[model samples]
Target: MSLLLSFGVLVLGFHHLQSIPDSWSQHYVFVKFGKEHTLECPLQGEGISWICPHNARSICSKASTRQKTLHLPNLSHKKSGLYTCTNALHQSYSTYLLIDEGQDLLNISCTSDSYTSSVLHCSMDKPFTGPSLLRVRSYSSNMTQEGKEMKIPQDENQNFLFDIQLPNSCPSEELMDPIQMSVEVMSSHEYTSRDLTFYRRDIVVPKTPENVTFTKEKIMWSNPSWTPYPSFFPLLFELTVRYRNNTIVTKRTEEQNYSAKDVQTIRVRCRDLYNPSSWSPWSPRLNVRA
Candidate 1:
């Protein structure tokens, strides 16, 4: 494959050639390394010559074509380029040859978790035995933002999953803003990339839960609840408490035992999922007695 700027371009007779006219048949094909390729010459006749893209002069000697067909076996880096065929009158036909060194088996699938938009899950069809890295980027309102490389464990299936959290206090304009996400899978030797464009209007941070009621195992602590509504996306709830005993922030879960702690103060907040870094502000504090 043409891996760098110097190796990737179409040049003809000194100046850089961008494209050919339709009359030229515009034959362009990609060949993998160590593969055979055949180039068909147009306007057949005698004194036929072939010119390689990198070199200025025509190829001479035994490296000639037969019956307007040039057969190349075991393709390599030295064989990669635009090949031009010409007649004695200087009339010529050309084809752009691209060398693909990347593994043809590589493919990626990326999807936002239906349970939670914050969590983007991606996987590769081909397993990479070598060093591998997965990178993601988001573009919104003409600005591009990038996330940290997610850990892709070398597993039997080569599958990977990760989540990205959006800020809860993000402005109203940004909630519905379009997000362009590009995911790249790289190996020690070769790499491939793909892009996804989406937006989150229904997945904005959840409003703070309300209706505070308290009970005391030791110090009275208020349990807050919100008027439940139908939710389209995954949601996570956060609780921030400040009391005479301690100040703490924690997510609500079935295993949580808040009454056991000498909780003196109480407030709460919640957000729709995307592993967002920010959360809703502390709600109005409840007067709980010790």
Candidate 2:
């Protein structure tokens, strides 16, 4: 009977031990770029050592065996990885770290007139992160030419506006497309890396109407004098809008008196003014019946 009782007690004790919770539990998660963060891991036993993944560095908390915390600073992209905390009581926990790619403030606009300067504006939404470095790149589609990198300092909260001289040699009228602009932001901290974000706005140009059709004509004469044929009038359309990489042109015929047998074909094409070698497929030929 005593042996039976002892066996029962042992079994109960073992079951109770198995149900015990881990000694360590993660209390907080921290992530930051170009800065430091503190992580908290609570443990129940003494001699608790927290080891981080980067290099097996040890962080000690003397507050209590049941509680531990560590401070991580000067974080960068390379520091982004799994972090682990462990203690002598066989307690362990893990977490992940992420550094934001950061953010930038930028504005870009273009104009067609050759005499005026093209405007490029840039800024940083959060100047507290550090001094911001701005870079501008421009490209001409027609000439297949890329401009030099232009740099500026962005240390304030307000927008940074800068005037850029358009390429002195504009693409010939046939090849001149709107200029393309891109911006990149760099962290002031030498240890941190930066990324590029692009903002594109095209130049607004006038367009010629295409597919001119006449449903019917109004007549003032009392007699019914109508012909199945319509007249064709001379219509002129100019390429008004410009694109940084491409061009679009549209043409339409003017409304005029036409004989019943008149049929006109309309064709429109878009090409890169700078690089004459490249051109867009011509729009489908439109047939006008008069």
Candidate 3:
């Protein structure tokens, strides 16, 4: 009888250890900043209790508690932390609560110089006052590029700029496939992330047209030197003509030459023929004689 009791005690201790979850293993819970959320303990018993985040017991006091659930009415950055739930048997579970603003607070813009260029330039237009960290990553069909985390210093104008280079050059052919991109901004108490999808052709900004000359009721210009395979990837040129009477006329065409009867000044710009989302900066104004 003594041996059986000892064996039964050993079995009970082993079962108790198995019931307890690892303290280091924490499940992540994401919630919007100003929304209400309820956390349910995994262990259901009579003596179940919750341990609030360190130094944040006051915030938990405002929460409503049921038998095994804790309901938080207003979620904020201060409420984000590790929450542990314990039962009568001393078994416990932990969860990390992460709260976000749930909106695109960064207002990030990313673009490439050319369709075939491997480098992408990204900028944040939002003006921030404090120190923060910025990270950007890109995912293509065959490649993934992870960006390096860098500290963002406070600037006078509050604008921040960064560059991301892909592992391979963009494909020349028109591809419908889009590259997935994500930008993450981390601060002392707040974290925000934004995801963007774009095609290479959509973000290509052609170089400004050059060598503009006007003669004999006709205006001619040289295409951008950086443009590759002029026939395969055609460019659409936009011509802006200002007359002596202060009247302005804009015309778009695939040809680099234009003919007009009267003009005082003429400027030209170009964009991708297929994808016309981005236009290059206007070329230098060429004075013309009537």
Candidate 4:
């Protein structure tokens, strides 16, 4: 992610501060996150001095002035906002200054895929600009469900990457939406927040079943410990059984008992219980005289 979002333009409907000329093309400066960005206040002529923005007690920030330019450093979320520059005449060239964590100042990205595996990938954008701590946590899109999160990977360089395993899909309504994650970058006086989502579709799959066992009159089975599919809860499996006569039966549970005398041939397969199910191929035919 890019640390710098936008520069040289007023954003989010913020109007310019009063006191500048109508023709001055540059009145706004936006800084990137995690590092220092400079803001220059150009004056038409001298005799007019530069005054920093302030209230009753302190200015928004203490800055270094060369002539008309102001130097600000290590910008983050809290450092962002408006700063006006006034001259001795009380007339101002109040440049609307804004600072934000760079495009991905936290220098991070996260994702999960059904084909690869069910895991969260997180990493820094690059080497460290300054010392900081990063923490990653997971939650459901809605506030109700949370706590199934992965850990942040550790690395030697300031730029680090790691993978955290995700839990198998839970069999509940809470798993319907995408999984949300918050990556917090913590420094002494500043912090950055980055959010990413793992779409539910990418972590979902009809995992292969456990050993399919057949007894004289009873059929029983279970599912694998986990599947690569995206899900917040265990998946519902729709089980199908084919009889010797080629008749078929599908059920929501994993087990079935046959009581008929002709229950000699059986083949079984399963599918995910969600809409437009992902069905598996029929199991090998099992024939026995009992």
Residues 1-290 of candidate 4 have per-residue lDDT tens digits of 12222223321111222222222123233344556655544444554444443321133333444245555556444444444545555555544333334335555655443323546655566323444445556665344332322222334566667665554444343345567766654332223457777565444444456566676557655555455333533445544556667677766653333333345555555544443344545555666465
Instruction: Give the C-alpha miss distance for residue 180 in model 4, angstroms.
Output: 2.1
Q: Largest TM-score belongs to which candidate?
A: 3
Candidate 2 local accuracy as lDDT? Answer: 0.34
Q: Whole-model lDDT, candidate 4?
A: 0.46
Candidate 2 vs candidate 4: the lDDT winner is 4
For residue 258, what is the lDDT in candidate 3?
87
- TM agreement with the true structure for every prediction: 0.37, 0.28, 0.63, 0.32
Candidate 1 lDDT over residue span 183-270, tens digit each: 6544322334566665554333334555644564532222223213323333455565665656665556322234535556666665
Residues 1-290 of candidate 2 have per-residue lDDT tens digits of 22211111000000001011122112222234557765555445665555444432332333332345556567665444445556777877654444433333333433332212244333333322334334445554444233333233334545445544443342233123555555443332211123332212223121223333323431111101111111211122222222223343333222222222222443443321322222223434554444
Overall lDDT per candidate, in order of appearance = 0.49, 0.34, 0.67, 0.46
Off by over 4 Å in 3: 1-76, 79-98, 127-129, 155-158, 243-247, 261-263
Candidate 1 vs candidate 3, TM-score winner: 3
Q: List the residue pairs that clash in candidate 3.
A: none
Error of 1 at 178 (Å): 20
Model 2, runs deviating above 4 Å: 1-32, 42-51, 55-67, 86-93, 105-264, 267-290
